[model samples]
Target: MVPIDTPTLGDRSYLAHDGSVALVVDPQRDIDRVLALADEAGVRIAHVFETHIHNDYLTGGLALAEATGAAYHVNAADEVSYARTPISDGDVVEVSPSLRVRAIATPGHTFTHLSYALESVSDDGIEAVGVFTGGSLLFGATGRPDLLGHEHTSDLVHHQFSSAHRLADELPEHTHVLPTHGFGSFCSAGSTGDTTASTIGAEKRQNPALTQDEEKWVADTLAGLDAYPAYYAHMAPGNSTGPSAPDLSTPESADKETLATRIASGEWVVDLRTRTAFAAGHVTGTLNFGVDGQFATYLGWIIPWGTPLTLLGESPEQVAEAQRELVRIGIDHLEGAATGSPQDWTDAPLGSFERAVFADLAQVRHHREVSVLDVRRTSEFDEAHISGAVNVPLHELLDRVDEVPSGEVWVHCAGGYRASIAASVLAARGVHVVAVDDSFDEGAKPSGLPIAAA
Candidate 1:
């Protein structure tokens, strides 16, 4: 089975076998690595499954399907524009002579969320060997309940609770658990002790939220979740029933002229190349959210929820993955992409934002004249924080800014997406803001920095 937190730079890759075929779960935009591995293994990907209409990176399922001709699978209840077969709880799909899959409705993370049980070969795909928990269940965590909007949070909580409890009580104790998202993903409620893959048994023992009753589960999740990125709402409705994804098979490289036009036309250009590659030289102003790592989640944070987005990547697949990743977070009002320079477009002038790493942060502290705002959840602040920062998670930043002293506010998060959203919230309200990246651990402390928390 392909694990999420491997030595590889990619999100996660799993190849499950019932002895005859392979099933791939939630292949994020970083597919080249896995595709190459697939080639080496000499195995054809039989099924590409997405647990939900993702909100992190765009689903590579569509591209993987196009590339390998695998059947694209999603929960029957989910609505996406792409062509896919409906998968539901208790429905068994035969992948090979020995391997088979049974779908389980694991909603609450999303309305149409699902989990699949992979069974080993027997009389005919009978014994479930393990379950690929598509953001439904994790080693030390579970999926968030607010994705569908909290109108019926109470009900969604029960749905999620039921799903988790079912896994705990029904699934075999030895059944392997592979979750689609792990530590850095906004999908998981929280890091369950810095891990990506964990067993169902291990989760049942350690995950406090999983063991809690439904009431506590919902409360803890809502309380600890980082403020909902502004993009959350925007991406959900669009992804629910959006347009078919553009096919970028045998991708074409964008030229300097096309790149210039894209930047000028007021589109946010995201460079999905490696950080070192990005830092070496790039079109000035392009935001650097790398592809192989946490692109989907971070990109959703910086680009504002409903802003028109365009990609300025190194290759055609990079561009397509960027587009898909944006859509996963519900940013589907996509404008067409160009393959040339920014000067190609004279109508609009798109701006750029620099990559903020663990370094370059002391500038504000050195001056002792900048305000630091932390955009992680309240629990994260309680766990740790930067020496002198405030904890105004992105969700409350808009309403809570009145508490700040009103100065040059420099916002930051574990990386920078939430901080970017927090900064955007302040900017939209006529506040001067600069989003920073202090990682999450280093930014959790409260010193002279004007950060907020308990």
Candidate 2:
């Protein structure tokens, strides 16, 4: 088994093969990497299996199947409006003479979710090797059930509880557990330790979802859920309706005049340069969602759905990378791209902002009037924050801009990424802003600023 890790989405796709034949599970929209891996391994990809209709990233199943002449396998229960070989519980698929995969209806993360158990089938019998649990079970926690919307939350949680125990009870103790979510993925109920690979034996002994009583498990899982990116709402429908293949052609270069016109017409002009570089100089009205940080998540959170966007990057490679990340979240309306410094791309005078450490912010607060805005999540803010800071999560800042009083707003998140986002939003709104590009822990020190505990 080979794991394909997409760090941007914090998800994993797996290629399981036995010598000449292989199958891909939960692949991302970019199918090139999976193709390359299969080519390198000298194996034919005969099938693509989706454990569930993903609500996080666009799956490359259809495109991959089209390219490889492989059959796409989806759960029969999910009414996906696309061509696929509908699989049901207990259905066994033979990939090769030695490799066999069985679909087990998990039905936790989604109502129609399936977990595939790969086994080595010899003349003697079959031995289970690994199971791709997808979002049903993770290293420490199970997939959160709230993504189906609030109405299904209670029912899904109940299903999740039953599904987790079923996997534990049915799978062999030695079977390897591989999950698609929970490696920094927002789809997870919470952080599931750090390790990504484990066995059913290990999980049964240590996984909270498997060990806790059903009621406690449901309560804890529900309580631990955090706010996910706004773009997630579009994924389920896109997957159900069958997402179109991604067009990875190089984005056309937008000349200075066209860029300016688009900016004037209220198009999203995202600067994919470094945050420090963005702060030093940028096109006047552009928002900085630097590629160096959680670029796609923050950009998707703030940008309106279906907004035509253009990219400004330091190089062609940066623009290409940013485009790939954007496509994963279904943000594909990239109108054009420009690669150069701010001056090379535009004739307008460059904009700049002050970047401060926590100590600098503390001194500024002591000396002059400043509104400290904490752009971390409400949970993070409730745990602890600066005494006078107004909590406006980065995801909610665009709509709640008026809540921030007019003044020099000193913005900070746990680190600086969200703070940079908040600063850019405030700057675009013509609010005086000082982005505190420093650690919140250092800022909350007794020697620095007054810390408020919730």
Question: Largest lDDT belongs to which candidate?
Answer: 2
Across 329-435, the per-residue lDDT of candidate 1 in tens digits comes to: 44555555544333442234433333454445565467567666677777677766665677776556547768755777667777664554455345435566665
- For candidate 2, the TM-score is 0.97
Q: TM-scores of the models, in the given order?
A: 0.69, 0.97
Backbone clashes under 3 angstroms, per model: 48, 0
Please give the lDDT score at residue 447 for candidate 1: 26
CA lDDT of every candidate: 0.63, 0.89
Decoy 1 TM-score against native: 0.69
